[model samples]
Target: MNEDKNRIVSHGAFVVRYRAAGAYRFEAHSHPYLTVTSVMSGMLEAEIGSSHLVAAPEESLFTNSFQSHSGNGSDLEFVSVGITAEAVAEAAINAGFTKAGADIAFNNSYSSDRSVAEIARAIAAEVLSEEPGRNAMLDALISQLVIVLLRSHLRVKRSPLIELSRAGPVDRRLRRAMEFMHDNYSRDLGIEEIAQAAYLSEYHFARLFRRVTGVTPHAYLANLRLEQARELLINTGESISDIAGAVGYQSQSHFTKAFKAVTGLTPKSYREGTTRAVEPAEAGKAGLESSNKVSSGE
Candidate 1:
Protein backbone atom coordinates (compact mmCIF):
# COMPACT_ATOMS: atom_id res chain seq x y z
CA MET A 1 0.00 0.00 0.00
CA ASN A 2 1.09 3.56 -0.76
CA GLU A 3 -0.40 6.80 0.53
CA ASP A 4 0.01 10.51 -0.15
CA LYS A 5 -1.57 13.75 0.93
CA ASN A 6 -4.92 12.94 -0.69
CA ARG A 7 -4.45 9.53 -2.27
CA ILE A 8 -4.08 5.82 -1.68
CA VAL A 9 -2.76 3.10 -3.90
CA SER A 10 -2.48 -0.64 -3.97
CA HIS A 11 -2.48 -3.44 -6.46
CA GLY A 12 -4.88 -2.89 -9.37
CA ALA A 13 -6.70 0.15 -7.91
CA PHE A 14 -5.66 3.64 -6.81
CA VAL A 15 -7.91 6.38 -5.50
CA VAL A 16 -7.40 10.10 -4.97
CA ARG A 17 -9.49 12.99 -3.69
CA TYR A 18 -9.37 16.58 -4.89
CA ARG A 19 -10.73 19.61 -3.04
CA ALA A 20 -9.95 23.13 -4.13
CA ALA A 21 -11.30 26.59 -4.64
CA GLY A 22 -11.17 28.86 -7.68
CA ALA A 23 -10.71 26.91 -10.89
CA TYR A 24 -9.16 23.48 -11.28
CA ARG A 25 -7.77 22.84 -14.72
CA PHE A 26 -5.60 20.28 -16.42
CA GLU A 27 -4.34 20.24 -19.96
CA ALA A 28 -5.50 17.22 -21.95
CA HIS A 29 -4.22 13.93 -20.59
CA SER A 30 -5.22 10.32 -20.06
CA HIS A 31 -4.70 7.45 -17.70
CA PRO A 32 -2.79 4.33 -18.66
CA TYR A 33 -5.81 2.37 -17.41
CA LEU A 34 -9.54 2.74 -16.95
CA THR A 35 -10.77 5.52 -14.67
CA VAL A 36 -13.93 6.49 -12.80
CA THR A 37 -14.27 10.18 -11.81
CA SER A 38 -17.11 11.24 -9.51
CA VAL A 39 -18.27 14.66 -8.47
CA MET A 40 -18.95 15.01 -4.75
CA SER A 41 -19.76 18.72 -4.79
CA GLY A 42 -19.88 21.65 -7.17
CA MET A 43 -19.57 20.66 -10.83
CA LEU A 44 -17.05 19.07 -13.23
CA GLU A 45 -16.81 19.99 -16.89
CA ALA A 46 -15.04 17.59 -19.22
CA GLU A 47 -14.38 17.03 -22.89
CA ILE A 48 -14.15 13.47 -24.13
CA GLY A 49 -13.41 13.20 -27.81
CA SER A 50 -16.09 15.42 -29.38
CA SER A 51 -18.43 15.32 -26.37
CA HIS A 52 -18.59 18.11 -23.82
CA LEU A 53 -20.56 17.59 -20.63
CA VAL A 54 -20.87 18.56 -17.00
CA ALA A 55 -21.10 16.18 -14.08
CA ALA A 56 -22.99 17.26 -10.99
CA PRO A 57 -22.87 15.99 -7.45
CA GLU A 58 -23.32 12.23 -7.22
CA GLU A 59 -22.74 11.89 -10.94
CA SER A 60 -19.79 10.05 -12.42
CA LEU A 61 -17.62 9.87 -15.55
CA PHE A 62 -16.08 6.78 -17.05
CA THR A 63 -13.23 6.56 -19.46
CA ASN A 64 -11.89 3.85 -21.69
CA SER A 65 -8.33 2.59 -21.51
CA PHE A 66 -6.07 5.41 -22.69
CA GLN A 67 -9.03 7.66 -23.46
CA SER A 68 -7.96 11.26 -24.01
CA HIS A 69 -9.85 13.84 -21.95
CA SER A 70 -9.37 17.39 -20.71
CA GLY A 71 -11.35 19.56 -18.33
CA ASN A 72 -11.53 22.53 -15.95
CA GLY A 73 -13.94 23.47 -13.18
CA SER A 74 -14.56 26.09 -10.53
CA ASP A 75 -15.00 25.41 -6.81
CA LEU A 76 -14.72 21.73 -7.59
CA GLU A 77 -14.38 18.77 -5.27
CA PHE A 78 -14.26 15.22 -6.58
CA VAL A 79 -12.69 11.79 -6.22
CA SER A 80 -11.36 9.41 -8.82
CA VAL A 81 -9.98 5.92 -9.07
CA GLY A 82 -7.92 4.32 -11.78
CA ILE A 83 -7.84 0.60 -12.38
CA THR A 84 -4.37 -0.21 -13.62
CA ALA A 85 -4.07 -2.06 -16.90
CA GLU A 86 -0.34 -2.51 -16.51
CA ALA A 87 -0.84 -4.57 -13.36
CA VAL A 88 -3.37 -6.78 -15.07
CA ALA A 89 -1.20 -7.07 -18.13
CA GLU A 90 1.73 -8.13 -15.95
CA ALA A 91 -0.38 -10.79 -14.28
CA ALA A 92 -1.58 -12.01 -17.66
CA ILE A 93 1.99 -12.18 -18.93
CA ASN A 94 2.98 -14.22 -15.91
CA ALA A 95 0.04 -16.54 -16.58
CA GLY A 96 1.29 -17.21 -20.15
CA PHE A 97 -1.25 -15.05 -21.95
CA THR A 98 1.44 -13.28 -23.95
CA LYS A 99 -0.75 -13.44 -27.05
CA ALA A 100 -4.10 -13.00 -25.34
CA GLY A 101 -5.77 -9.62 -24.90
CA ALA A 102 -6.82 -9.66 -21.25
CA ASP A 103 -7.09 -5.92 -20.52
CA ILE A 104 -10.58 -4.35 -20.26
CA ALA A 105 -12.03 -1.14 -21.70
CA PHE A 106 -15.11 0.97 -20.92
CA ASN A 107 -17.44 2.41 -23.58
CA ASN A 108 -19.27 5.29 -21.94
CA SER A 109 -17.75 8.64 -21.04
CA TYR A 110 -20.38 9.67 -18.51
CA SER A 111 -22.71 7.82 -16.17
CA SER A 112 -25.46 8.96 -13.80
CA ASP A 113 -25.98 5.43 -12.54
CA ARG A 114 -26.67 5.70 -8.86
CA SER A 115 -25.02 2.41 -8.16
CA VAL A 116 -21.79 3.40 -9.87
CA ALA A 117 -21.73 6.87 -8.37
CA GLU A 118 -22.39 5.46 -4.94
CA ILE A 119 -19.65 2.93 -5.31
CA ALA A 120 -17.16 5.48 -6.66
CA ARG A 121 -17.94 7.86 -3.83
CA ALA A 122 -17.58 5.10 -1.31
CA ILE A 123 -14.22 4.16 -2.72
CA ALA A 124 -13.18 7.78 -2.61
CA ALA A 125 -14.23 8.05 1.01
CA GLU A 126 -12.53 4.82 1.95
CA VAL A 127 -9.25 5.93 0.48
CA LEU A 128 -9.43 9.26 2.20
CA SER A 129 -10.38 7.78 5.57
CA GLU A 130 -8.01 7.38 8.52
CA GLU A 131 -9.64 4.24 9.85
CA PRO A 132 -7.85 0.95 10.49
CA GLY A 133 -7.09 -1.75 7.94
CA ARG A 134 -8.20 0.42 5.01
CA ASN A 135 -5.74 -1.31 2.75
CA ALA A 136 -7.57 -4.58 3.22
CA MET A 137 -10.93 -2.82 2.97
CA LEU A 138 -9.84 -1.20 -0.27
CA ASP A 139 -8.88 -4.54 -1.72
CA ALA A 140 -12.39 -5.90 -1.16
CA LEU A 141 -14.05 -2.73 -2.46
CA ILE A 142 -11.88 -2.71 -5.59
CA SER A 143 -12.79 -6.30 -6.40
CA GLN A 144 -16.42 -5.30 -6.26
CA LEU A 145 -15.69 -2.20 -8.33
CA VAL A 146 -14.31 -4.31 -11.11
CA ILE A 147 -17.53 -6.29 -11.18
CA VAL A 148 -19.58 -3.10 -11.18
CA LEU A 149 -17.58 -1.56 -14.02
CA LEU A 150 -17.90 -4.69 -16.08
CA ARG A 151 -21.64 -5.00 -15.43
CA SER A 152 -22.61 -1.40 -15.98
CA HIS A 153 -19.87 0.66 -17.62
CA LEU A 154 -18.33 -1.61 -20.20
CA ARG A 155 -20.61 -1.50 -23.20
CA VAL A 156 -20.80 -4.39 -25.61
CA LYS A 157 -23.41 -2.74 -27.82
CA ARG A 158 -21.03 -0.58 -29.79
CA SER A 159 -17.92 -1.51 -31.67
CA PRO A 160 -14.81 -0.90 -29.63
CA LEU A 161 -11.83 1.11 -30.84
CA ILE A 162 -8.72 -0.83 -31.67
CA GLU A 163 -6.65 1.94 -30.13
CA LEU A 164 -7.43 5.26 -28.52
CA SER A 165 -5.56 8.38 -29.57
CA ARG A 166 -3.56 10.36 -27.01
CA ALA A 167 -3.23 14.13 -26.98
CA GLY A 168 -0.61 16.28 -25.27
CA PRO A 169 -1.45 18.64 -22.44
CA VAL A 170 -2.83 22.09 -23.24
CA ASP A 171 0.19 24.19 -24.13
CA ARG A 172 2.01 25.85 -21.25
CA ARG A 173 1.96 29.09 -23.22
CA LEU A 174 -1.82 28.92 -23.22
CA ARG A 175 -1.90 28.26 -19.49
CA ARG A 176 0.27 31.31 -18.91
CA ALA A 177 -2.07 33.38 -21.07
CA MET A 178 -5.11 32.12 -19.17
CA GLU A 179 -3.54 32.95 -15.83
CA PHE A 180 -2.64 36.37 -17.09
CA MET A 181 -6.25 37.08 -17.97
CA HIS A 182 -7.51 35.87 -14.60
CA ASP A 183 -5.12 38.18 -12.83
CA ASN A 184 -5.45 41.19 -15.09
CA TYR A 185 -9.01 41.13 -16.38
CA SER A 186 -9.64 44.50 -14.74
CA ARG A 187 -6.93 46.16 -16.82
CA ASP A 188 -7.07 47.17 -20.44
CA LEU A 189 -5.49 44.17 -22.19
CA GLY A 190 -4.64 43.42 -25.76
CA ILE A 191 -3.75 40.32 -27.76
CA GLU A 192 -0.18 41.55 -28.06
CA GLU A 193 0.15 41.97 -24.30
CA ILE A 194 -1.43 38.61 -23.55
CA ALA A 195 0.69 36.88 -26.16
CA GLN A 196 3.82 38.45 -24.73
CA ALA A 197 2.81 37.22 -21.27
CA ALA A 198 2.67 33.74 -22.78
CA TYR A 199 6.09 34.28 -24.41
CA LEU A 200 4.59 33.48 -27.83
CA SER A 201 4.22 35.47 -31.02
CA GLU A 202 0.87 37.23 -31.50
CA TYR A 203 -0.28 35.07 -34.44
CA HIS A 204 0.73 31.76 -32.86
CA PHE A 205 -0.78 32.58 -29.49
CA ALA A 206 -4.02 33.81 -31.06
CA ARG A 207 -4.60 30.62 -32.99
CA LEU A 208 -3.79 28.32 -30.08
CA PHE A 209 -5.89 30.34 -27.65
CA ARG A 210 -8.90 30.08 -29.95
CA ARG A 211 -8.23 26.40 -30.59
CA VAL A 212 -8.15 25.59 -26.90
CA THR A 213 -10.97 27.80 -25.62
CA GLY A 214 -13.02 28.25 -28.82
CA VAL A 215 -12.68 32.01 -28.37
CA THR A 216 -10.11 34.66 -29.09
CA PRO A 217 -8.27 36.08 -26.09
CA HIS A 218 -10.19 39.32 -26.47
CA ALA A 219 -13.50 37.48 -26.34
CA TYR A 220 -12.35 35.34 -23.45
CA LEU A 221 -11.24 38.33 -21.42
CA ALA A 222 -14.46 40.14 -22.31
CA ASN A 223 -16.55 37.25 -21.05
CA LEU A 224 -14.55 36.96 -17.85
CA ARG A 225 -14.70 40.69 -17.17
CA LEU A 226 -18.42 40.71 -17.88
CA GLU A 227 -18.92 37.83 -15.51
CA GLN A 228 -17.13 39.80 -12.81
CA ALA A 229 -19.20 42.84 -13.71
CA ARG A 230 -22.40 40.84 -13.29
CA GLU A 231 -21.31 39.66 -9.87
CA LEU A 232 -20.53 43.21 -8.80
CA LEU A 233 -23.83 44.44 -10.18
CA ILE A 234 -25.82 41.88 -8.24
CA ASN A 235 -23.81 41.88 -5.06
CA THR A 236 -22.90 45.50 -4.72
CA GLY A 237 -24.23 48.96 -5.52
CA GLU A 238 -21.20 49.90 -7.60
CA SER A 239 -21.99 52.46 -10.29
CA ILE A 240 -22.18 51.22 -13.86
CA SER A 241 -19.05 53.07 -14.86
CA ASP A 242 -17.23 51.89 -11.76
CA ILE A 243 -18.06 48.30 -12.50
CA ALA A 244 -17.15 48.83 -16.14
CA GLY A 245 -13.72 50.30 -15.39
CA ALA A 246 -13.09 47.70 -12.69
CA VAL A 247 -13.47 44.97 -15.31
CA GLY A 248 -11.36 46.55 -18.09
CA TYR A 249 -13.93 48.37 -20.17
CA GLN A 250 -12.85 51.95 -20.94
CA SER A 251 -16.26 53.31 -21.96
CA GLN A 252 -19.63 52.90 -20.19
CA SER A 253 -21.45 52.70 -23.52
CA HIS A 254 -19.22 49.88 -24.73
CA PHE A 255 -19.50 48.12 -21.37
CA THR A 256 -23.28 48.38 -21.44
CA LYS A 257 -23.43 47.07 -24.98
CA ALA A 258 -21.09 44.17 -24.26
CA PHE A 259 -22.71 43.27 -20.94
CA LYS A 260 -26.15 43.28 -22.54
CA ALA A 261 -24.87 41.15 -25.38
CA VAL A 262 -23.74 38.36 -23.07
CA THR A 263 -26.37 38.60 -20.30
CA GLY A 264 -29.41 39.47 -22.41
CA LEU A 265 -30.19 42.54 -20.26
CA THR A 266 -28.80 45.99 -19.71
CA PRO A 267 -26.82 46.41 -16.52
CA LYS A 268 -29.53 48.59 -14.98
CA SER A 269 -32.29 46.21 -15.93
CA TYR A 270 -30.36 43.22 -14.62
CA ARG A 271 -29.66 44.94 -11.32
CA GLU A 272 -33.27 45.99 -11.03
CA GLY A 273 -34.64 42.59 -11.95
CA THR A 274 -32.33 40.78 -9.60
CA THR A 275 -33.06 43.04 -6.64
CA ARG A 276 -36.76 43.52 -7.21
CA ALA A 277 -37.62 44.85 -3.78
CA VAL A 278 -34.99 47.58 -3.79
CA GLU A 279 -35.54 51.06 -5.21
CA PRO A 280 -34.37 51.18 -8.86
CA ALA A 281 -32.05 54.08 -8.11
CA GLU A 282 -30.54 52.28 -5.13
CA ALA A 283 -30.28 49.06 -7.08
CA GLY A 284 -28.49 50.68 -10.00
CA LYS A 285 -25.95 53.23 -8.93
CA ALA A 286 -24.55 55.72 -11.43
CA GLY A 287 -22.10 57.36 -9.04
CA LEU A 288 -18.65 56.13 -8.03
CA GLU A 289 -18.86 57.02 -4.33
CA SER A 290 -17.85 53.86 -2.47
CA SER A 291 -19.09 55.37 0.84
CA ASN A 292 -22.56 55.75 -0.62
CA LYS A 293 -22.93 52.17 -1.84
CA VAL A 294 -26.45 50.92 -1.21
CA SER A 295 -25.71 47.26 -0.63
CA SER A 296 -23.41 47.99 2.29
CA GLY A 297 -23.76 51.65 3.31
CA GLU A 298 -27.50 51.33 3.81
Candidate 2:
Protein backbone atom coordinates (compact mmCIF):
# COMPACT_ATOMS: atom_id res chain seq x y z
CA MET A 1 0.00 0.00 0.00
CA ASN A 2 1.09 3.55 -0.69
CA GLU A 3 1.26 6.22 1.99
CA ASP A 4 -1.00 9.29 1.92
CA LYS A 5 1.01 11.97 0.18
CA ASN A 6 -0.63 14.69 2.23
CA ARG A 7 0.53 13.04 5.43
CA ILE A 8 4.18 13.75 4.78
CA VAL A 9 5.55 16.84 6.52
CA SER A 10 9.25 17.50 6.39
CA HIS A 11 11.55 19.85 8.15
CA GLY A 12 15.24 19.72 7.22
CA ALA A 13 16.05 17.88 10.46
CA PHE A 14 13.20 15.35 10.59
CA VAL A 15 10.12 14.05 8.78
CA VAL A 16 6.62 13.37 10.17
CA ARG A 17 4.49 11.11 7.98
CA TYR A 18 1.91 8.33 8.02
CA ARG A 19 0.72 5.43 5.92
CA ALA A 20 -2.74 5.19 4.35
CA ALA A 21 -5.10 2.47 5.50
CA GLY A 22 -5.13 -0.79 3.57
CA ALA A 23 -3.67 -4.27 3.67
CA TYR A 24 -0.11 -3.64 4.76
CA ARG A 25 3.04 -5.73 4.60
CA PHE A 26 6.69 -5.30 3.74
CA GLU A 27 8.71 -8.08 2.19
CA ALA A 28 11.96 -7.10 3.93
CA HIS A 29 13.19 -3.66 2.96
CA SER A 30 15.67 -1.34 4.69
CA HIS A 31 16.45 2.35 4.81
CA PRO A 32 19.62 4.35 5.36
CA TYR A 33 18.40 6.40 8.33
CA LEU A 34 16.45 5.88 11.54
CA THR A 35 12.73 5.15 11.27
CA VAL A 36 10.52 5.45 14.36
CA THR A 37 7.01 4.04 13.75
CA SER A 38 3.86 3.68 15.80
CA VAL A 39 0.81 1.51 15.27
CA MET A 40 -2.28 3.48 16.24
CA SER A 41 -4.56 0.50 15.61
CA GLY A 42 -4.35 -3.10 14.34
CA MET A 43 -1.65 -5.60 15.16
CA LEU A 44 1.74 -5.49 13.43
CA GLU A 45 3.93 -8.57 13.26
CA ALA A 46 7.68 -7.85 13.19
CA GLU A 47 10.37 -10.49 12.76
CA ILE A 48 13.41 -9.06 14.46
CA GLY A 49 15.46 -12.18 14.51
CA SER A 50 14.36 -15.58 15.71
CA SER A 51 11.52 -13.89 17.59
CA HIS A 52 8.42 -12.28 16.16
CA LEU A 53 7.64 -9.02 17.95
CA VAL A 54 4.04 -7.89 17.77
CA ALA A 55 3.11 -4.20 17.91
CA ALA A 56 -0.47 -3.43 18.89
CA PRO A 57 -2.28 -0.17 19.28
CA GLU A 58 -0.32 2.63 20.93
CA GLU A 59 2.90 0.68 20.58
CA SER A 60 5.87 2.07 18.63
CA LEU A 61 8.89 0.53 16.94
CA PHE A 62 12.43 1.69 16.11
CA THR A 63 14.48 0.58 13.14
CA ASN A 64 18.17 1.33 12.82
CA SER A 65 20.03 2.23 9.65
CA PHE A 66 20.24 -0.49 7.01
CA GLN A 67 18.17 -2.84 9.17
CA SER A 68 15.81 -4.93 7.13
CA HIS A 69 12.26 -5.24 8.54
CA SER A 70 8.86 -6.29 7.32
CA GLY A 71 5.32 -5.93 8.69
CA ASN A 72 2.00 -7.64 8.05
CA GLY A 73 -1.40 -6.32 9.12
CA SER A 74 -4.80 -5.40 7.71
CA ASP A 75 -6.13 -1.86 7.66
CA LEU A 76 -3.29 -0.66 9.79
CA GLU A 77 -3.40 2.98 10.81
CA PHE A 78 0.04 4.18 11.79
CA VAL A 79 2.38 7.16 11.81
CA SER A 80 6.16 7.32 11.53
CA VAL A 81 8.93 9.89 11.59
CA GLY A 82 12.38 9.38 10.14
CA ILE A 83 15.51 11.19 11.17
CA THR A 84 17.95 11.47 8.32
CA ALA A 85 21.44 10.13 8.92
CA GLU A 86 22.99 13.57 8.58
CA ALA A 87 20.46 15.03 10.99
CA VAL A 88 21.07 12.27 13.52
CA ALA A 89 24.78 12.81 13.34
CA GLU A 90 24.27 16.53 13.76
CA ALA A 91 22.07 16.03 16.82
CA ALA A 92 24.78 13.87 18.36
CA ILE A 93 27.29 16.66 17.85
CA ASN A 94 24.90 19.20 19.33
CA ALA A 95 24.48 16.97 22.39
CA GLY A 96 28.29 16.67 22.77
CA PHE A 97 28.37 13.04 21.81
CA THR A 98 30.27 11.27 19.06
CA LYS A 99 28.62 11.03 15.66
CA ALA A 100 28.24 7.27 16.15
CA GLY A 101 25.64 7.70 18.91
CA ALA A 102 23.11 8.73 16.29
CA ASP A 103 23.29 5.28 14.71
CA ILE A 104 22.03 3.53 17.87
CA ALA A 105 19.52 0.66 17.83
CA PHE A 106 16.61 -0.46 19.98
CA ASN A 107 16.82 -3.54 22.19
CA ASN A 108 13.12 -4.21 21.75
CA SER A 109 11.20 -3.68 18.54
CA TYR A 110 7.81 -2.66 19.99
CA SER A 111 7.58 -0.09 22.78
CA SER A 112 4.35 0.55 24.68
CA ASP A 113 5.48 4.10 25.31
CA ARG A 114 2.83 6.71 26.00
CA SER A 115 4.93 9.76 25.11
CA VAL A 116 6.13 8.34 21.79
CA ALA A 117 2.69 7.17 20.80
CA GLU A 118 1.04 10.45 21.79
CA ILE A 119 3.52 12.45 19.72
CA ALA A 120 2.77 10.26 16.72
CA ARG A 121 -0.96 10.70 17.23
CA ALA A 122 -0.59 14.44 17.56
CA ILE A 123 1.50 14.70 14.39
CA ALA A 124 -1.00 12.59 12.47
CA ALA A 125 -3.94 14.58 13.82
CA GLU A 126 -2.32 17.84 12.78
CA VAL A 127 -1.59 16.44 9.36
CA LEU A 128 -5.17 15.31 8.80
CA SER A 129 -6.71 18.41 10.34
CA GLU A 130 -4.89 20.78 7.96
CA GLU A 131 -4.24 22.94 10.98
CA PRO A 132 -3.13 26.51 10.47
CA GLY A 133 0.23 25.96 12.14
CA ARG A 134 0.65 22.40 10.96
CA ASN A 135 4.33 22.68 10.11
CA ALA A 136 5.30 24.17 13.45
CA MET A 137 3.16 21.71 15.38
CA LEU A 138 4.56 18.76 13.48
CA ASP A 139 8.12 20.03 13.91
CA ALA A 140 7.67 20.39 17.67
CA LEU A 141 6.10 16.97 18.10
CA ILE A 142 8.62 15.27 15.82
CA SER A 143 11.50 16.85 17.71
CA GLN A 144 10.14 15.59 21.03
CA LEU A 145 9.72 12.13 19.57
CA VAL A 146 13.37 12.17 18.54
CA ILE A 147 14.48 13.08 22.04
CA VAL A 148 12.41 10.29 23.56
CA LEU A 149 13.77 7.81 21.03
CA LEU A 150 17.38 8.77 21.77
CA ARG A 151 16.94 8.57 25.54
CA SER A 152 14.61 5.60 26.05
CA HIS A 153 15.11 3.38 23.02
CA LEU A 154 18.74 4.12 22.21
CA ARG A 155 19.91 4.83 25.80
CA VAL A 156 22.11 7.71 24.75
CA LYS A 157 23.34 10.57 26.89
CA ARG A 158 20.55 13.08 27.65
CA SER A 159 22.73 16.10 27.11
CA PRO A 160 20.46 18.48 25.24
CA LEU A 161 17.87 19.46 27.80
CA ILE A 162 14.96 21.80 27.01
CA GLU A 163 16.25 25.20 25.96
CA LEU A 164 13.27 27.23 24.77
CA SER A 165 13.23 30.95 25.28
CA ARG A 166 12.09 32.00 28.75
CA ALA A 167 11.98 35.53 27.36
CA GLY A 168 8.75 34.79 25.52
CA PRO A 169 5.77 36.48 27.17
CA VAL A 170 4.02 33.21 27.98
CA ASP A 171 7.23 31.64 29.20
CA ARG A 172 8.01 34.65 31.41
CA ARG A 173 4.93 33.82 33.46
CA LEU A 174 6.31 30.37 34.24
CA ARG A 175 9.84 31.46 35.24
CA ARG A 176 8.82 32.50 38.74
CA ALA A 177 6.89 29.28 39.25
CA MET A 178 9.83 27.26 37.99
CA GLU A 179 12.07 28.90 40.53
CA PHE A 180 9.44 28.37 43.20
CA MET A 181 9.35 24.68 42.39
CA HIS A 182 13.12 24.50 42.59
CA ASP A 183 13.17 26.23 45.97
CA ASN A 184 10.05 24.74 47.57
CA TYR A 185 9.94 21.17 46.30
CA SER A 186 10.59 19.97 49.83
CA ARG A 187 7.32 21.46 51.06
CA ASP A 188 3.74 20.25 50.92
CA LEU A 189 3.20 22.02 47.61
CA GLY A 190 0.57 21.35 44.95
CA ILE A 191 -0.50 22.77 41.61
CA GLU A 192 -2.71 25.37 43.21
CA GLU A 193 0.20 26.85 45.12
CA ILE A 194 2.43 26.70 42.05
CA ALA A 195 -0.20 28.35 39.88
CA GLN A 196 -0.60 30.96 42.56
CA ALA A 197 3.14 31.57 42.40
CA ALA A 198 2.82 32.25 38.68
CA TYR A 199 -0.50 34.15 39.07
CA LEU A 200 -2.09 31.74 36.58
CA SER A 201 -5.12 29.52 36.93
CA GLU A 202 -4.28 25.85 37.49
CA TYR A 203 -5.42 24.76 34.01
CA HIS A 204 -3.55 27.53 32.26
CA PHE A 205 -0.48 26.99 34.40
CA ALA A 206 -0.47 23.26 33.63
CA ARG A 207 -0.78 23.83 29.88
CA LEU A 208 1.92 26.49 29.81
CA PHE A 209 4.20 24.60 32.18
CA ARG A 210 4.25 21.58 29.88
CA ARG A 211 4.58 23.77 26.83
CA VAL A 212 7.72 25.29 28.31
CA THR A 213 9.34 22.44 30.20
CA GLY A 214 8.20 19.37 28.27
CA VAL A 215 6.86 17.92 31.53
CA THR A 216 3.95 18.55 33.85
CA PRO A 217 4.56 20.72 36.88
CA HIS A 218 3.99 17.81 39.23
CA ALA A 219 6.56 15.66 37.43
CA TYR A 220 9.09 18.46 37.35
CA LEU A 221 8.55 19.06 41.06
CA ALA A 222 8.91 15.36 41.79
CA ASN A 223 12.20 15.27 39.91
CA LEU A 224 13.46 18.26 41.81
CA ARG A 225 12.50 16.68 45.10
CA LEU A 226 14.19 13.44 44.17
CA GLU A 227 17.40 15.21 43.20
CA GLN A 228 17.45 17.09 46.47
CA ALA A 229 16.78 13.90 48.36
CA ARG A 230 19.70 12.24 46.59
CA GLU A 231 22.06 15.03 47.56
CA LEU A 232 20.99 14.66 51.18
CA LEU A 233 21.38 10.93 50.96
CA ILE A 234 24.95 11.12 49.71
CA ASN A 235 26.14 14.09 51.72
CA THR A 236 24.34 13.73 55.03
CA GLY A 237 23.57 11.08 57.60
CA GLU A 238 19.84 11.65 57.81
CA SER A 239 17.51 8.69 58.34
CA ILE A 240 15.36 7.57 55.44
CA SER A 241 12.10 8.74 57.01
CA ASP A 242 13.58 12.15 57.78
CA ILE A 243 14.77 12.50 54.23
CA ALA A 244 11.34 11.43 52.95
CA GLY A 245 9.60 14.00 55.11
CA ALA A 246 12.09 16.63 54.09
CA VAL A 247 11.40 15.84 50.46
CA GLY A 248 7.66 16.53 51.00
CA TYR A 249 6.53 12.96 50.79
CA GLN A 250 3.99 12.24 53.47
CA SER A 251 5.01 8.60 53.65
CA GLN A 252 8.34 6.88 53.30
CA SER A 253 6.97 4.14 51.02
CA HIS A 254 5.76 6.61 48.42
CA PHE A 255 9.11 8.38 48.49
CA THR A 256 10.90 5.09 48.12
CA LYS A 257 8.84 4.20 45.04
CA ALA A 258 9.54 7.56 43.43
CA PHE A 259 13.23 7.40 44.22
CA LYS A 260 13.56 3.90 42.84
CA ALA A 261 11.75 4.90 39.69
CA VAL A 262 14.47 7.49 39.01
CA THR A 263 17.58 5.97 40.56
CA GLY A 264 16.96 2.23 40.50
CA LEU A 265 17.72 2.03 44.23
CA THR A 266 15.64 2.24 47.37
CA PRO A 267 16.47 4.86 49.98
CA LYS A 268 18.25 2.33 52.17
CA SER A 269 20.24 0.96 49.26
CA TYR A 270 21.11 4.45 48.19
CA ARG A 271 22.12 5.69 51.62
CA GLU A 272 24.14 2.63 52.49
CA GLY A 273 26.60 3.54 49.71
CA THR A 274 25.45 0.89 47.29
CA THR A 275 25.92 1.50 43.63
CA ARG A 276 22.85 1.72 41.48
CA ALA A 277 21.92 -1.58 39.91
CA VAL A 278 22.33 -1.78 36.14
CA GLU A 279 19.64 -3.01 33.88
CA PRO A 280 20.91 -6.12 32.15
CA ALA A 281 22.21 -5.04 28.79
CA GLU A 282 20.49 -8.09 27.38
CA ALA A 283 20.71 -7.12 23.72
CA GLY A 284 24.33 -6.06 23.90
CA LYS A 285 25.17 -9.16 25.91
CA ALA A 286 23.63 -11.35 23.23
CA GLY A 287 25.79 -9.75 20.59
CA LEU A 288 22.66 -8.36 18.99
CA GLU A 289 24.54 -6.31 16.43
CA SER A 290 23.38 -5.48 12.95
CA SER A 291 23.82 -8.47 10.73
CA ASN A 292 22.24 -10.33 7.87
CA LYS A 293 20.06 -12.24 10.34
CA VAL A 294 19.42 -9.85 13.25
CA SER A 295 17.36 -6.92 12.02
CA SER A 296 16.08 -4.03 14.10
CA GLY A 297 12.42 -3.78 13.18
CA GLU A 298 9.73 -1.12 12.95
* lDDT per residue as tens, model 2, 152-261: 77644332332223211113557678778767878888899999988999999999877655457776676667756765665567899999999899999999887765
- Lowest summed lDDT window (length 10), candidate 2: 287-296
Identify the runs in model 2 with alpha carbons over 4 angstroms from their true place: 1-6, 49-51, 96-103, 155-298
Q: Model 1, range 109-157, lDDT digits (tens) per residue?
A: 8889888777777766665565655545555676566666666666422
- Deviating ranges (above 4 Å) for candidate 1: 1-17, 86-103, 156-298
Candidate No. with top lDDT: 2
lDDT of 2 at 14: 53
Clashes of 2: 0
